[model samples]
Target: MENNNNLNNSEKKGIGRRDLIKGLAAVPVLGALAFSTSKKNAYDQNLKNSILRELNIDASTPPPTGPMAGDPVRLGIIGYGIRGKQLVKAAGFMARSEKEKLQKSALENPNDTRLKDFMEQENLNVRFTGVCDLFDVRAEEALDTVTTDDNKPKRFGTYQEMLASPDIDGVIIATPDHWHAPISIDAARAGKHVYVEKCMTHKVNETYELYDAVKTSGIVFQVGHQHRQTQSFVTARDVLRKNVLGHVSLVQACTNRNSDNGAWQYNIHEKASPETIDWQQFLGNAPQIPFNKEHFFRWRKWWEYGSGLAGDLLTHDYDRINCLFRMGIPKSATASGGIYTHKDGRDVPDVYHVVMEYPDFQMGTSQEKGKEKGFTFMYSATLGNQFGGRNTLLMGHDATLELLGNTITVHADPRSTRYKEMIKDKMIDPEVPLYSYNPMANGVDGVTSATAKYFANKGLLFTYRNGKRVDSTHLHIREWLSGIRNGTKVSCGIEEGFEEAISAHMTTLAFKLGRKIEWDADAKKIINVTEEEINQCDFITI
Candidate 1:
């Protein structure tokens, strides 16, 4: 009976890639499209256990309940900058069910914008215990905003002090890129769970160090690639697993936003100065320099402080694809482009392009059966142009999967043998999308302000579940907190974070050196590169 039920479920799922292969076994055209039956079973097993949990769907692992219920996880925030404040606010966000009430209230009282800011604090499973920042004003500002039990967050002079405090169960590290590895390593060593913002680390060596620390510490660690929680991505993964797009040969991703803030010209706080900031602490591993307000506010502009395009923007784009296709570090990477637009004394590129080679990886590649010619993952970013909106495309022989913010479109290729029957029957079109998943059904939001739209336009800012809007950050934070209690791994934990880190570092290193960089999977080092070659890159001053 159980076997019958399993068979019924599989049949109900309908005409997946494996089914197409078996159906078209006599046809020569379908030979290249056939994949191993084991692959489908593996995907099904993983989807049932892991991907479903990531999508906030019913999973075998129960959410923290009983003794764990209402026991708020004590969270310490290490950086009170833009991302820090966002994380703090997300911690206090109301669940989707309550958010529906707030939306209804907004419709009745149109003038009351405060309904949007309403957070059902009692329901929140995490509370801010301490806030730390090298900038005194920013730290205090963050503390003033976070309130639990009519309680204000205590300010810590440094992250080290906050890490030493027994009050903090976990630490959210939102500091500059260079500080990520150092703080995360220390936090892990101190046996504190971590939620580190992305780019993961400054350099390749520190990436390994941070991974090692997190692995040995036995604590929950979540990288800030919150897109892993986005429902469309989970849907896209299922679509990919079905082999609807056939063997994906190439992937193209872009980051295009022609705005001052988008280029990292963030408004410098008036209180920013040597008197109000720990300049030395902020410049820990970087070369010592006098306090510069521009560098303090717009740290993404420099190689000394940030990973520029590769780490700042490409990581977001790359991680989204990585989440869907589980493509680990590439075999080789080569990069181009330079600081063509925003020339505000920035050392890193304003526009960049990177091509990463995945030679051995076959999951998302064109490799058929035993053949082993890998696919290429290409990334392009420009701060000067928003001509083509930010998006990603996975090109396959049968179809192309296009992801544009909250929308996913599967366009069938004219040459596809798998879609031949559908095409001959006029079921599939060459121009129009064969399938589309739009989670947002309410067209343009009536209540959302202009500022909300701007931020939402950025990667994975918002997603939907069961046709109701959900905060990706809120879900991501809750996942981390739940994982801490239930001993379940997070969506973008150490393993996922490691892949993102290495991939970003590979692009950054290749671009900076003006050469091609190859990942030696066996030795875990860049092939044909020396310490001198690495040191020559501006970002690798250490």
Candidate 2:
């Protein structure tokens, strides 16, 4: 997990003033050179502003309360792709509102002029700091949206350059999957906290590297598994934990979409040109190939940059499932699927299913321990978007819980005849006291009857548990900020992020190898591979 920052110093030795001038000098000769040049300038200005904001030396005198309260932590965003842009909008809204509130409070009391001026300065306080991308245009575009009047962050043509900046307190990485690990590792080594997008790393082994670096760097880290923070999911977790559904054994989850665009057939922008896209940066550690707009914009379609639907969709399910069950990495994982619909030359599967097994565990010492039944997770995703519509079912011995959209329904196990009879008896039990006169006598039967009454009154034939759900989006972001401020471990820390990534990789392997692969969880290696077979396919890195 630790990074070698010193290596960055060595990398800087090669790019000098002449090299920079020569690079810029050749730009005009290239197609759409003017656009590239302007984009580059815009990125540079953005980086400069970001630097000022990081130091709290920008015009905004009094920073709004963040994790550090009086001393707000500066966040430098590295990519301005879709997710990065979204983060900027979110952070911008937060900063602007805080500034407005401070201004209003200052006006209420003339003695607050100092705070007023600070608010004015802070209004334009955030610095874009540093931007780097293989495509000069993407870096430029990211810079343009980040800069403000008082702050200008430095712009780097490459992520390596961004990490070299001393002003950055933390970096928000929304790069392609291939670039996620390297850039994050480099930033961590440079002593900057990291907030990486979902499916943290592309390679399985890279997960271990990230986990080690974060542990040693003493910097906060958060993974973009926002679903974990959702209120509905939280409510689901509570109901499951409370065993309202009895002994849970099987859990099924899925995400289905039925549109050309939904299936990642993204609309190719007519404006996309060499000047605005960073082709090289997008390529990162993936095998070098010709600059293709399709690959650059719709990366999830290819195996080089992404693990297809598994990483994009399945990983989210894995993270949430892990959270709900308090399970570690899956004991074993197997998958099957293919490109059944999309005829494009994409390397990823469109329809896929993966099954994870968690064998039973025992509680207490060996002599006194009792075995606890384990559970199976059946996960699936389809391109057709069938209308039985998408949903997750957590089935237990007592009842089954269904989560679809915002509504959650719990049903008594259809196979439980005995429980059904008991429920029916409770409904007719006139002897059942609304307020028990003899509390001691109203024992097991009273508790069971009361449970049935609670569900019956809600118009639910089966027992149901409901409540106001948590807003996962806010919770996930808050968790990240909190981790940064307190140096605490994040819910989706590096280890979990890595495991999720690894699980996705395994799915891809299963499809390609056309066989069920057994993973040695302890050794963290593919168990069934022979030496000769190993040389044929590159092993998955975390």
- Give me the displacement of residue 344 in model 1, in angstroms: 1.5
Write one digit per residue (lDDT tens) for candidate 2, span 1-542.
12323344554545555556766987667757777888989886665454223222111111112453444456677776656755554444223444565578667755444233232222322345666555555556666656667667677767676677777777888877777888788888888888888778877667678878888998778787765544345555665554455566778977566677657776676767766676666776777787798998788888777777788878877776776676666666788887888878987888889887776521111111232366778888776564344467766665667764334566655443324554454421223211111111222211123322222221111111122222233345556666767555567787778778777766666666776666777787767655345333333322
How well does model 1 score by local distance difference test? 0.76
lDDT of 1 at 425: 64
Measured against the true structure, the TM-scores of the candidates, in listed sequence, are 0.81, 0.69
Residue 60 Cα positional deviation in candidate 1, in Å, after optimal superposition:
15
| Per-residue accuracy of model 1 over 155-233 as CA lDDT, tens digit each | 8898899999998999988999999999999999999999999988888888889989999999989999877777677
Q: Any idea how many clashes model 2 has?
A: 39
Report model 2's TM-score to 2 decimal places: 0.69
Report the poorest 10 consecutive residues by lDDT, candidate 2. Answer: 433-442
- Runs in model 1 deviating more than 4 A are 1-68, 93-122, 150-152, 364-373, 442-459, 536-542
Evaluated at residue 398, the lDDT of candidate 2 is 55
Against the hidden true structure, what lDDT does model 2 obtain?
A: 0.61
